[model samples]
Target: MQAWGYVSHQIPLLSFASRLMNKLLAERDFSGQEICHVLLNCELQEGTRVVRAVDCRPYEQQGRSLRLQGDHDDDAEVVGIYEKYLSRPALHGELTYLDFLANWNTSKRDGRKWTRWSRQAKPRVLYYFPRYKSNPQHHQYDDFCRVKLMLAHPHRDPNELRKINGVEYDSYASAAEFCFANHQHPDDYYGTPNAEDRRPDPDEFEEEFHEPDLLDEDWLELARQLPDCPPSQEMVDLLGRRDIDIQYDWTPHVGRYADPGIVQGDYWRQRIAQNPLYMDVEDLPSEARDTLNAEQRIVYDTIVGHFQCESEEQILLHVDGGGGTGKSYLIKVLSSHLQKLARNRPSPIWRAAPTGVASNQIMGTTLHSLLRLPVDRAFTELSPADANALQNKLRDVRYLVIDEKSMLGLRQLSWIDKRLRQVFPARAVEFFGGISIILVGDFFQLPPIANKPLYFDGPLKDLHEASGQIAYRAFNYTVFLQKVQRQQGDDQASFRLALDELRGLKLSIESWKLLSQRVQAKLGQRDVDSFVLIRPMSHTLDPTLPHFKFLGKRSRKCSGAARESCGQWRAL
Candidate 1:
């Protein structure tokens, strides 16, 4: 491979072929021997400069005996391959490989299978190729830069040269011919002079990357004021309701200058009930409710009491706890109670999390999916049609339980609040659109990414962050669970202490020694089967581990040993 690497221009082609065969063979049940036979039989156009699969210039060898025509199945399979690999807009009406196959008889000379090769009859148009900005002499550096540039242009279309100067060609083929005639690479025509050949001028050095200066302040002061903003009609209607928000205080809404159905309060009670989970919460055993610890009971009772109330007052509560504190257990109990209260109506209790894995644990969806929240950006105002669709989708959702609150960033929560308000304009003034929201998770686990945490204090950056902080602060009550339910046994006291110290980032010598002892311990055969590794991404694990099962009993033994505390294994 290193020997062939010197032919740098062909490296990409080799890599592409390797990936193509790997994917093709993986999809089909082709053995390596069968693949080798296919490669041996297939003609390799080594001298051809292949830019695409279509450019491979395939030709049949003499007396190889061509497959009979009218085999629809084989033809269809070949067509499917072309469609998957070579069917791009540029080749839309051109004579593709399929067309060449159809016209094979015409191209054959005295029954010989070989055909004459020529440039494709494409439309005569101005051709463009990006200027290669690297020195070809330094092949390694140039190859890297070329790969980066190739990746930047994902779509295989010719670019429009902004300044054509005197270098112009009617087609790409003509340009290549001109380059060959001049005994120079086509890239050299437009490429900037190499570093050693040309030094930077004073004007180039003086170039500023900063934004250009704006007009004078007196001119900027003439900037017109934004139009008078007003809340959506639904918000006005919600405020007008005598049943809820009696004061009708229509103060201006905040966040992103933006932006369900169901009635207020017990209006959900009047609607026909249809349970989505297909389970009767009423059938849940009394022991489920009875098993709650004192701390859990307080939160459970407060939530249940609010659900049973006649008023439409929104409940925003946070259930804060550490690991193994029965927070999940409490959520299960509360979900059941909420279900029982809602009766036959669609379970008003919807659960969501910042991530899919966390949501799956509680039989919920991710908040982004559930709320149609934007990724990596602030939420924008939705179109009327989209808002209507979102409203209908979430009409029956009265209570939302968000798990893994620690992973929920300020910007994300702000998006949630903003989206909910837009969707249920009537409840726009209320935090999270007047829906009873229950937040459950340990802050000690993992903090939000690229954004401030829910508990972020100090100075605020922008109104976006400020809005989320305000929404979080709106939670009327909080329940803190301190019990370590999972590792409670006397035998696991040391493990519990270690976990506690680890969470607080104040690990003691005692905890460290306990962890060190485990590091030195060996795993038994039974331990290997029971042990499971958890990672945020599967790619983070050993890539070759999946191959262990295919290597038979010996590899199984190797994998088991690899799982042992002290065992070490590395691929050569």
Candidate 2:
């Protein structure tokens, strides 16, 4: 049977072992020629051994009553091979003969260490209690499966094993638990090309695939801005019959991925048609269209999607510009559009900024609050609990929007990626998916307090390198937003001036000196013509407020007069 290695991770341990045994046995065999018979299913009438060598078990004193897997004693390599099949570490030599060790036979071990399964039989759960017949403890506790029981055990031929094909698990929740323990998922086995027979029942698939439910607080206030959805009779029925929830992708609500071509081709033929907002891209008002400048337009077009869905890697929405140039405005405007996009689909979204100061304007909670990282926490792989909690909290959201992307540090970005992939292993948070992250900020602002600036060097760079795994995770994915819409036609001149300086776009040295001194000096007549740094703040209040917690005490020299008139800054 065909199976996706990744999704199979969600299956339970027992089911996993069973499936592993079946798949491994079916794929390879004891005899090279006989194996081909097993593969074809054409020579079923012939009696044949079901499986080849099993992983090892050594005997006491190198002598057991019988040889195993056709070896005279025990074949160390066969046992080692079994471990490798289970993805367990393999031993280069023999499995250290545990039977001869001092601890051997010290206690009555109840569980089976090695077992062989048969078709048409309930798995014979092997158990080993010491073979002490007349021992004092044997009288009190049942030590073995007595002959009475063994004699009654039913027997079946090897052909019956083929009947034990796919597992018939009871519940999706149970199946999910099994899948997780096995480090696999149902999706791995269900939709695989050769494993169609193993697919979950439609009802179970629905439960497994649906979008996660949303929390009441996750919605933006009064954000009922429905997307531009087209109406259709089939969609009307689908929406009317289903109790679909608007959720994000990391959690449970997500279903199987649908082809956009199928979605967009006869997309409208369905019950719930396209998103309310997916009409003619050209007819959108120019202001709405221009919100994504030339560069942004290129990114939007390159995304190759209609509405967002799950399973992708890396996402970068770079909105670069100076202050007040409408960078934040574009994001704020798109917030609803984003919400509508996620709401319209089956997958959910998780949105946050990389820093506290920046997060305040966007997600309402602090970055640490969403991440749950302690103040002194060092970045590491998220604990299973942390991963579980994050998955639970982040199930369904359409996108991740980070304000002040420029301030995001390496550790911060790494943390986000690890946490994201842990929860939604299919579509990593760094990747683009149903989520289209919009990063709003200027790179020139600041990097992390613990990381090097994108352009920083020396001390900062070395420190980041020494930070270990957290720093290593930093290498995942990267996106840089570019554009300058924040400044007005003339206001952007400030950045152009700086860019000019760096690119040898020059002004005389005297002009540069005059501009730098503006922060300390009053504007002279010549300075008036240059760019003036204006604070919307009034001149009357104490200047001390500009410095946090530095409000100066009220001072009165019998005749009140301003001690310093003012300081004006100039930029060329």
- Per candidate, the number of residue pairs that clash is 5, 59
- Candidate 1 lDDT at 378 equals 59
Off by over 4 Å in 1: 1-283, 376-378, 520-529, 534-572
Model 1 C-alpha lDDT per residue in residues 1-572, reported as the tens digit of each score? 22223333343444554566789868986466667777799643343332222211111211222445574755322232222223333433333333332222222222234443454632111112322434545634343333222222222222311112356656433433343355422231122324333323435334443422433444346654555577888878786566656665456542423312232454455443643433223345546867877678777666665555533767676677788999877777778777766776766678889998998777778898888888867579899999998898788777789999878877788889999999899989888888878888876666666666776664675677889988877765566677888887899998998888776667899999877765425656676567676443211112222212222322211111111111232110
The TM-score values for the models, in the order shown, are 0.45, 0.34
Error of 1 at 556 (Å): 55
lDDT of the candidates, in the order given: 0.57, 0.40
Best by TM-score: 1
- Model 2 ranges off by over 4 Å: 1-287, 300-326, 344-350, 363-365, 380-386, 426-441, 453-483, 490-520, 524-572
Best by lDDT: 1
